[model samples]
Target: MKEIRVGLIGFGTVGSGLAEVLLAQQERLEKRSGLRIRLAKVADINISEMPPQFGDVALTNDAADLIGDPEIDIVVELIGGIQPAKTFVMNAIAAGKHVVTANKALLSQEGRDIFAAAARHGVEVGFEASVGGGIPVIKALREGLVANKILSIMGIMNGTANYILTRMTDEGIPFDEVLRDAQQQGFAEADPTYDVEGIDTAHKLAILMTMAYGMNITHNDIATEGISRIEPVDIEFAREFGCRIKLLAISRNHGDHVEARVHATMVPERHLLASISGAFNAIHFTGDMVGNVLLYGLGAGKMPTGSAVAADIVDIARNIATGSVGRVPPLSYLPEEISDRKITPMEELSCPYYFRISAVDKPGVLSAVSGILSQHDISIESVIQKGRKQSGPVSIVMRTHTALESSVSKALAEIDALDVVAAPTVKIRILEEDE
Candidate 1:
């Protein structure tokens, strides 16, 4: 048996959980892999309040001290953000240490430079925990599905936003109310901008695009629309029409171009992703060889994320013992092999739409609404008119067939200009059953 010495940075939620799992599963890991995983040292901003589980292990306030430790064979980084995390990883690689990280933001933003440094140092960068927590989607893409050309990837990446949306749909609560509840329950952050504004999902999508389609993505390149604008009324309307509003991170290859985006989507109730509610995560992958495959599990939390990190630790330990650390590229493709295909713009995206028009109940109102669609060359598939809810106007829901988003915007503009219009039209894209 071989012993692998470990250095951990940041004993926050994820870091502490990693320590817990390693301590609890010590016997099983050694029995299964014939390797003893030892925590040689732990580093955090404040080392004075170290947990009792840390036992007699060495502790330090400076992270670089752990990276430079001669006995540490692997360094696990869970201290997220761009600044010192990036600096720490680079310095660890420079010291000839294998690295495992769960920092998706750092990888998505500066993966190219990090991968280049790892190549120069001849070390493996294991980051399975970055994307879908314990779901193993990264491993599936890089190894299991390597035989196929991925057609598309649509994921429910943010558990916080998903929990809020699911509560709004099931409990008939407003967005703000659900968000407040999520925060109180610790499911959401004090500043929920990253989760609700779609920036967090964008970071995950950038990583997925690199592994699935072999493309380098900058966070700015993705067209992101958040769930902040989604309302309970929209959720009710979606349920009435066999659909659910979910914040989806989607990426697809279109000839020489790729479409990568994160937005509030209306997925059909029958779709597998629609059934995934609360703080769980799920992703549907369409591959040429395997067709549609779904990966579902706890997206985040201490134990789930820690399990993923531990798996990587086991892998690196086995490879180290064999003296043959494999060279599986970080992006799963050589830099020269990745294509320079631009992400398709939002205007080019084509999908059906669910439009709810608040207008005065009067003669010729339906004709006026239909006329606007015709002017934009849009086609309406169905229409539902609800009874008057208020004195000012009533809601008229219209379902349209596949149409370009640019045409939908044009039709919406024209509809809002009518004399009968009460407020801005509420429009949500209607995802197809198969898509």
Candidate 2:
């Protein structure tokens, strides 16, 4: 049997998991693929206590040793971030080694240059593990759904944010409390700015937008809003309005522009996406022919991500055994075909909104707010000021019809300036998709 040699970098959680899975499933994978897969080397700055099964594998502190090795057929970079990871991947492709990575941050931000280098070298780069851990959405979009033009891509891509929001909404726990619990359970990082603040989702969304729309879009193009400000009161308000709050990464192609945004969105109770709970991930895509498709699975964690990475490695091995390298362009489409479709600015994005205004218990306050919204062409769909009478301040919840984000922002500022409005107004974008 032809042997495929693999070199793994960054033996952390995901790297360790991949090593363990490969060890346990090597015989089965080889039997199924009719080729042998061997993990020849592992590299990391600080190596941890690995299981005894990997004792024979060469362990090293230097990345150059693995990348420069002529016997290595594939180099898997689990060392995330932009700098060294990008440099390592680019070098591996130059050295004639196929690359597989779970680094969404680097891929979304710097994929254009990396994929271009892979194309130039006539090598392949696999990032099936980059977006949804073990969901296989990448393969679906790049290959399975290749026959159709994808209309939209939306999902709960970040598990940390999803856990936080899911716990908060389901258990009625406060955001801070739920986040702390999630941290204790290893679902969230100590500093979860990327996940909770929506940067992580933006990264994944950028990669999805690239595959779905064939655009060279980056995560920076997304307008991000975190769930940190989401209070239990907001959850209660959503429940009252028959909606659920989820931090959604959404992107779609308009007639002339693409819409990319990440925000705490109001998903209806009846929508399938509204029920995706806990630290799980789900991607819903609308293709021209398929209409709608939803993928759900663990979006993060060692085993799930390892499964995704291993699948990519095996796919690459199969491609190598068939002598068809670079068979699929790095981003699913041909390198020459990736377009530079523009992303619509946040100001131009239009959607229904749920707003909570904390104001003094005074008459005519609703009228004043309505006047400002009407001036901006925003019409109120409904309002609820029930049971807030005897208080120093009251939160009046309101829902608006579809309106441009810029107009809503301006109207919100005007509403916030009123003396009757005691505190800053809160706004959550409503998900108004048809069934």
Candidate 3:
């Protein structure tokens, strides 16, 4: 068996798990690939925290040590970020080494340049773990679903956000309380901004849309809204309306344009996406030929994400041994083929909405609210009042008929400005089965 050496950068949580997988499943992977996969070197500044499983593997404080090594056949960049990781990946490719990575942010922002570099060097870049941790979604999109024209992608891509929202909905706790608990339980980072604020989800979605649609979609192209403002009352309303509130990364391929956005979505209970709970991630994408498909699994963690990275290593090893590297482009589209598509503006997004408004318990408050909606060409499907408080405001929940986002925004603006309205109305986009 020809041996292929693999160098890993950043032996952190996912890196440690990769070490564990490589140590424990070395024989099986080599047998499956018909190529010996050797753990040649690990580069991490904090080598003290390296897992005990890495018995005698070489360690270096510098990443270039591995990138420059001519013997290293594959460079797995697990150091998550844009700066040094991007430089290292580019360098490894320039050195004629294949690359595997799990950096969604880097791939979304700088993937065009990185893929261009890989193509120039005739090296493959495998990023199976970038989006869905262990779900193997990238492979499915790049290869499995290659035969079909992808129509849309709807996903709960952020495990931290999903975990927080799941806890909130299940325990009836508030967002802050659940977030704190998630942080303590190691589900969320201390900052929690990227995951909770939908930026992380946007990065993942941009990667997916690029692969699915062959459009060079970047992270900033997706309009994002966080789950920080999700309230227990909205959860109650979701249940009442046979729905569940999930932080969703959604994108659709309209004939001439694409709809890409990340926001808190009201998914119906009957949909497969609604069943995904806890720290789990689920992607529901539609294809022209195959119709709807659902992939569910752990979105992030030690073993799950590492398992994904290791799978990519197996793929790269197979490519190297077969002497057919660069068979698949990084974004599943050749560099010249990835053209810029128009990302649908936020104001034009059309969806049914769930609105929670707090208003003074006055007679014509409903009339005033409806008047604003009518003025903006917004129409209501159903409305229910959740009883009144003694002296202050009462909650009114309304589900609107499908309306343009601009109209809803303008109506909400007019409604919020009314003296009877207590606060800015809470709006959650409803994802219906038809869509």
Candidate 4:
């Protein structure tokens, strides 16, 4: 059997897990893959103390050692960042080595250049772990659903954000309180702007959109909104409407253009997505032939994500063993077929909306608000007034019929500017999914 040597960079949580999988399951992997897969070297900034089980493997601080090594057939990059990770992966590809990575940020931002370089170098890139860690969604999209025309995708891609929202929905906890608790529980990072602000979800969405539509989309192209503005009162109101709020990364293909956005969306309480609570992740895909398919699992962790990385390694190793490199394109589309598609402007999209307006209890407040919405061509579907306050502002919540985003924005601006309006209006999109 041909021996395919593996070199891993970054010895952090995921890297350590990959090492464990590669070392502990060496014989099993060889038997399953029909090739001798070996962990030849590991590179990290700090390698002062090596793990006892990896005594036979070489360790180095310089990543170039792995890229430059003639025997190293695959370079696995577990480091999460843009700088040196991009440089190292590019150099590895330039050296004619197959690459596997879990860096979503880098791939979402710089995938075109990276994939183009790989194509030029005649090596495949495996990045199944980048989007939904260990969920195998990437593989499913590339192979399993390749024959179908993907119509739409809605996913809870960020664990930190999902965890925060799940707790808020279940316990009626406020966003701030839940976020603090998630941080304490190691579910959120100290500086969680990426996860909480929907940036992380957008990154993963970009990757998925690329695979689904064969389009050149990036995180910057996504219209992103966070969950920081969500409150306990909003969750209560959602329950009144028989719904739950989840931070959703949504994309839809419209023939000429595509829609991509990440925001706090109100989904029907009975929907499967609303029930996906806590830190777990779920992605719902709509394809022409498959109709609707869901993939759910742990989005991030040591063993789960490590398992994804190992699967990629074995796949690439099998390709090497058979001398059939580049059998599957990284994006599941031919390089020539992948091109920039028009992204529909967020303002042009139409959807039903939920609005919470703080207004002083008065005789003409409702009429005035409805008048403004009507003028903007937004019709009210339902309205609720919570409590009565003679002096202070009371919450007036309204659900509107399907309206263009631009019209809603204009109406909200006019309503918020009224003398009776006390605060900026809080708006959330309502997703009407088929059962």
Candidate 5:
């Protein structure tokens, strides 16, 4: 049997778990793939704290040792971020070594350059663990669903954001409270900016869009909105409408342009995406032939994500064993076919919206608000006026018919400028069941 040596970098949570998987499952992997897959070396800044399972493997602080090694066939980069990770990946590709990575942020931002380098060097790059952890969505899009045209991809990609929203929805807790609890529970980081602010989801969405639509897009191109603004009252209103609020990373392919946005979306309670609670991640895909397919699993963790990394390693190893490294293009499309498609501006997209307006508890407040909506051609579907206070601000919740986002913004601006309006109107887009 052919021996394909593997070098792992960044022996952190995912790297350590990958080491365990490759070491523990060595027999099974080799038997299944007809290749001796070996975890040959690991590189990290602090090698003194290396795990016991990797005692038999070589360890180093400098990543160049692995990249320079002639026998190492693949380099798996788990060290995330843009700086050294990008440098390491480029160096590995330059060395003519197959690369596997779980860095969504780096890939989403610097994928074009990395893939270009790999193409130039006649090597392959496997990044299955970037988006959905162990969900294998990448392979599904690249291989399983290749026969069909992908219509849309809506996913709950970030575990921290999902956990906070799920807790807030189920327990009626406020956003800040749930966020604090999530941090204490290790579901959220100390900053929590990337996950909560939808940056993390946007990164995954960029990767998904590339794989599905072959669109040359990045996270910066996505219009991102976080869940920090969501409150218990919004959750209650969503419940009243028989829906749930989830921070959704949504992308749709129009023939002319694509729609990509990450925001808090209200999906009907009966929808599968709505029912995906807690930190578990789920992606709902609509394809021309497949209709709707849902892939659900833990989006992040040591073993689950590591398993994804290992799957990539095995795939690359098999390709190496067969002398067919670039059998599948990194983005599941020919390099020349991937082009920059126009992204539909968020303002031009039309969808039903949920609005919570704080207005003075007076009869004219509704008339003023409705007049603004009517002027903007935004028809109201339902209205619920919460408990009133004498000449004090009251919450006036309204669900509008399908309205252009620009129109909604214009109408909300006019409405908020009214003297009776007490606060900026809270707007959350509604995802219809059929959509």
Candidate 6:
């Protein structure tokens, strides 16, 4: 059997995992693919800490060494960051080597240049593990559901955020408290801003949007909202209304435009996504032909993520052996065929909302809030005014049907202006099953 030599960049969490998978599965892979997969070289910022299993394979602190290594045929990049990782990937592609990466941030931020470099060299770039850690979502959107028009995708993409939210809902704890626990338990990073702030989900959503819609998009265009503002009261209120709150990464393809947004949403309790707990992730995609399909599993882990990287290596090796260069389009369609449509802004999104308002227990307050919604042509689906906990403040739950985000904002603004209301309104997107 011909051997496919691999060069790995960034021996971090995912990189080390890749090494373990290839070594452990080498025998099984050789039987299945009839090819020997070898690690010709590995580049990391700190090579001294690499586990003993790395053995005698060439190791270097400099990434450039791996790009031009003659023994390396396919370059697998797990190095996360903009400058060096991008430079290494582009250089590898320019050197006429196939590339595989799990760097969704880099891809979502600068995929255009990376793909161009691969196209120039007539090679393929595999990123099946980029978006969803273990779920073959990139493959699903790119190949499996190729014939169907993807209507929308709703997911719990960030495992850290999901873990925190799940704990908050189940244990009735505060966000900050659970985040500290997550860090201590190794479920979150020391600086968890990216995952907690919705930036991580935005990157994943950006990649998914490109694959599903064949469109060029960036992380900046997506409307992003973090879960920092989610209150436990809202979670209890959601349960009372038969719902659960989860951070949702959403994208939709309309006839003329595409909508991308990531935010905390109140999904009904019966919804599949709402049931996902802890660090697990799930995504529901509605396609014109396939109707509704779901993919759920460990969104991030050493072994699971490593399996995805190994799968890409097998693909690259098989393609090389068969004398076939290009496999599938990088963005799920030909470069020139990618869409140029704009991503609809958050203010323009249309969906129902769950609002928690604190109002003074006085005459005509409910009518005043309803009047504001009616003025904006936002129809109310239901309203619950809780028993007054105090004479000055009360909690009200208002559920509405589909309406424009701008209209909802305006209505909330008007409702806030009333002297009876105590504070600004807190709004959570409502995802209807049939919508």
Candidate 6 scores a C-alpha RMSD against the true structure in Å of 1.9
Instruction: Spell out the clash pairs found in candidate 1.
Output: none
Better of 3 and 4 by lDDT: 4
Higher-TM-score candidate of 1 and 4: 4
Residues 1-435, candidate 1: write the lDDT tens digits.
678999999898999899999999999999988999987789997658667767767889989889999999999999999989999999999999999999999999998898889888888899999988889988888888989899999989989999999999889999999999999999999999989999999999998898888887877789888888788878888888899999999989876899998888899988889999999999889999999999999999999999999988988898898887755676778766876678898899899998989899998999989988998989999899988866789889988989998899888988999999999998777779868
The list of candidate 1 runs beyond 4 A from truth reads 360-366, 417-422
Worst 10 residues of 4 by lDDT: 386-395
Runs of candidate 4 exceeding 4 Å displacement: 388-391
Worst 10 contiguous positions by lDDT, candidate 5: 47-56
Candidate 2 ranges with C-alpha deviation above 4 Å: 48-50, 386-391, 433-435
Per the 3 Å backbone cut-off, how many clashing residue pairs does candidate 5 have?
Answer: 0
Residue 343 of model 5, lDDT score: 97
TM-score, every prediction: 0.95, 0.97, 0.97, 0.97, 0.97, 0.94
Cand. 4 TM to true fold: 0.97
Q: Give the poorly placed runs of model 3, Cα more than 4 Å off.
A: 49-52
> Where does candidate 5 stray beyond 4 Å?
388-392
Encode model 2's per-residue lDDT on 247-267: one tens digit a residue. Answer: 898888785788999999999
lDDT of 4 by residue, 1-435 (tens): 888899999989999999898888988997798888989998998777579988888999889987899999999998888998899999999999999999999999999999999999999899999988989999999999999999999999988898998898888888888888988988898999999999999999999999999999999999999989889999999999989999999999999999999999999987989988888899999999989999999999898899999999999999888889999898999999999999999999899999999998889999999999999999899999988646699999999889999999999999999999999999999988663
What is the per-residue lDDT of model 3 for residues 217-295, given as tens digits with 9 covering 90 to 100?
Answer: 8999999999998999999999999998999999988979999999999999998888899999999889999999999
TM-score, candidate 3, is: 0.97
lDDT of each residue in 313-416, candidate 6, tens digit only: 99878888888778778677888888678777777888888998998887888888888899999998888888875566988889999999999988898899
* C-alpha RMSD by candidate, in order: 1.8, 1.4, 1.3, 1.5, 1.5, 1.9
* Candidate 5 structure quality by residue, lDDT tens digits, 1-435: 888899999988899889888888989997899988888888898766556766668888889988999989999999899999999999999999999999999999999999999999999999999989899999999999999899999989999999999999888999999989988988898999999999999999999999899889999999999988888999999999999999999999898899999999999988889989899999989999989999999999999999999999999988887888889998999988999999999999999999999988867888888989999999999999998746578899999889999999999999999998888889999999887
Pick by TM-score: 5 or 6, better one? 5
